[model samples]
Target chain A: MTLLSFFNYWVVIILMMVGFYCVIARGNMVKKIMGLNLFQTSVFILFVSAGKIVGGSTPILRDGVEVYSNPLPHVIVLTAIVVGVAITAVGLALAVRIQEAYGTIEDDHLRDDFDEEDD
Target chain B: MSPNELFDLLILALLIVCALAIARTKDLAAAVILFSVYSFALCLLWVHRGAPDVAMTEAAVGAGVTAVLFFYTLTRTGRREK
Candidate 1:
């Protein structure tokens, strides 16, 4: 494999880890969502990168063109972007409600509030 | 290795380091900021991979819109107690 290709793969992997770490370790709802976004973005990057072909043109069908980077990844990314935005919107709305219901957004604090109410 | 390869590696290392820091941070805002960094790094990676459209989406939605949403939520909610 070429050095450039090697670098791209490693970068995507590294970014993925970072996003996962944030989602898993952070205590706040918003931070968790941010991590989730990062994770999804990294995945999108991975898909797009995997679809690339050296010296390939846009996936438009053309005369005498035998090689083209897969357009499937591009279409997938577009769909994913829309989904990600929708998720973020819903998550934010949930966060707002959580704030109203518990007067706090922190996961630990929200849990504590729930326990107090249960008691 | 070529300069481009070296740069990519460096960016990858930075992305990992930022992610680790985000995970370790107790402050929610800081974690979100680190997450944005991770997203931005991934956007660059996508561009390098020749997916400019995907990279653009990542930059705009992942790093921009999502980060703003996170910050908005953080400001709306209180921090965890000690």
Candidate 2:
């Protein structure tokens, strides 16, 4: 309805597109993982922003404070952050292994190397 | 616009720059550094929006742990994109 609200979602979408472009256009495995990280972070921002109330304070309770922001997204995002870290760790480990196996982590090189091995 | 919106606009601008920087860089290390900056902006955005828990998590995981992990991987692999 309003420009501000629309901008919020638009920013997330734009960020996601950037990450997606990195994932698809880039050839380096590490860069792909970074792109994936960027993508996930954008989604987290979108969810948290959606849970925020215009006139609300943090979820902490107080004697006279009302209209606290939603805590569900916060909890969900906390869990997601841990999962994201785990994923990143595993991805980096895989990148390291890919380099050791192929002598290079570039996607094209890896594909070529794997094909050579198959032949 | 209000102060909060103004801050959000600034962070949004920095985020765009960081994303573009990460995308265009051919140096893997430089890209990781840009990603660190991007994550810091994300953390600040969360703090500005009153989500301290998420902010902390973003700082620790996105900026801290993830960066370290990538650098470790970079050590094992070469740093150039090609």
| Candidate that would win on DockQ | 2
TM-score of 1: 0.78
Worst lDDT run of 10 residues, candidate 1 chain A, spans: A53-62
Evaluate fnat for each of the predicted models and list the values in order. 0.65, 0.75
Question: Can you tell me the DockQ of model 2?
Answer: 0.82
Docking class of 2: high
- Candidate 2 lDDT score at position A68: 76
Candidate 1 lDDT over residue span A56-104, tens digit each: 6656666988877887888898898899899988988898898798777
How well does each candidate superpose onto the true structure, as a TM-score? 0.78, 0.96
Which 10-residue window in model 2 chain B sums to the lowest lDDT?
A: B1-10
Task: Judging by lDDT against the true structure, name the best candidate.
Answer: 2
Q: Which segments of candidate 1 are over 4 A away from where they belong?
A: A2-18, A55-68, B78-82
- What TM-score describes the B chain of model 1? 0.87
Instruction: List the TM values for chain B, per candidate.
Output: 0.87, 0.96
Supply candidate 2's per-residue lDDT for A8: 85
